[model samples]
Target: MIIRPRPHWIHLLFVRRGSLLPRILSQQIFVLLLSCAVVVVHGQLFHWKVTLTSAPFSLMGVALAIFLGFRINASYDRYWEARRLWGTVLIEGRNLARHALTLTGGGVDARPFVLGLIAFAMAMRNQFRGRPRQEGLEGLLPAETVARVQAARCAPALILLWLGQWLQGVREAGHLSPMLAQHMERSVDELSAALGGCERIANTPLPFTYTVILHRSSYLYCMMLPFGLVDTIGWMTPLVVGFVSYTFFALEALSDEIEEPFGTMPNDLALDAIVAGIEASLRELLGETPAPAPQPDAAFILN
Candidate 1:
């Protein structure tokens, strides 16, 4: 997502990054052209007045806006929940690194466990965006371990399982106490919960039927809107309809993008940066320098 600070109030009028303008511009142009035609014809077909009243449209607009409001609310809930789950990942990752190293009393090399945490975050990020790249794992895991996970189903879960077994092995080797291992296991479980929560959001979406209904209704209302206004507004119908169409189209596009917060869109969550931050935190515990900072694209999006 775009990572820059909020623009100044005056500059906010001209904001582009994360703006809804790009997606809706074409549709708005079409609606505007349609409005112009409706104005030229004045809702008349073959000289028969296709009289349409603004009263019905005004009432319908209120109802449609309410439904759109509900959809936007639902989408924002998903977006916020995704953010919170990642926040959990960050906190739990840092905690795991500290607890694992300290409780092991330097008797065990913590690199493997630390790498497991990083791997889980990277794998989860890849799963969310459907961009599967394995280069990030080379620094964190051995070739053999990476090769084994590359073929596994739910690679993150599998890597976590290996970490659990590693902890068990350390316990057997007389490094970690059973209690410390159990505590570490709970952190892993919370990580699992966070992952499961994100998967739920990513895999599940707003119902298809609702989307269909909303889309058709929006188009119908916008197209028919000029008919309702052409008689009353006359030559100015295009300008007025264009402004109204912009609102409806922009809101709809915004809702669609934010509904799935894990995408590479400007408004979507910055999973790459979040994963990088997790890697940096874990690597620090391993006495490694921080990961290089993530830079935003020309649109100021950190995908």
Candidate 2:
């Protein structure tokens, strides 16, 4: 996701990196050219003067803006919900690492449990981003464990199973008492719930019909806007249409990008950085030097 510092107002007006302008530029240009043609023809088609007025467009624009606002709010809700789920994953991961280190008796190596948490986070990220299940698991987990996770249909769920098994082994070996094991198991359950939440969001998107209706409405409104305004605004129709179309197009594009927060879009969630942070926190809890935190790229984007 875009992670740059806020810029000055003047620079912000021209900023391209994280803005929806790039995505909607083509639509904006098309609307501008269409408006120019309408103005040139004086809102006529085949020698027939198309009698139109801005009254209908004004009313329609208001309704369209309201619907676009609603769509954007819905998309943002999904994005924020995904971020909260990842936050829970991080918190529960840290809790699990701490329980493995302090709650368990001595000589119980907590590294494996902590590593499993890291692997789980990676698996979730890969699953959401539609990447290979075993893309980044080799160095984080044992060969056998990696193979098991790779083989499983749900890699994150399998890693959670392994984590539960590790806790059970600790309890069986007398390192973790039953009570403490149950307490730690609560964290595991929380992790499971968080993973389930992410999966739900990833699987169920905003209704396809709703999106299709909005998409068609936005484009149709822009396409016909020039005819409505050409007679009223004359040569200024193109400029007005360009500005209005840009607003509508940009909003639609922004909503599309953020609707699926797990995507690789510039506006999507920073899954790689989030998983890395979780790994660092768990490793630090285990008394190991955490890897350096991820930095945004030259364009100030963290994937």
For all predicted structures, in order, the TM-scores are: 0.93, 0.95
Model 1 spans > 4 angstroms off? 295-303
lDDT of 2 by residue, 161-201 (tens): 88999999989999999999999999999999999998888
Worst 10 residues of 2 by lDDT: 294-303
Per-candidate clashes, comma-separated: 0, 0
Once model 2 is optimally superposed onto the true structure by TM-score, how far is the C-alpha of residue 221 displaced, in angstroms? 1.2
Candidate 1 C-alpha lDDT tens digits along 1-303 = 877765567767777667888788889889988898888877987888888899999999999999899989999999999999999999998898898888896657888888889988998887778765454777676777788777766777877787788889999998988998899999999999998999999989999888788888888999999989988889989988888888888888888999999998978998988999999888888898996877644454221
Candidate 1 lowest-lDDT run of ten: 294-303
Which prediction has the highest lDDT against the true structure? 2
* Model 1 superposed RMSD (Cα): 2.3
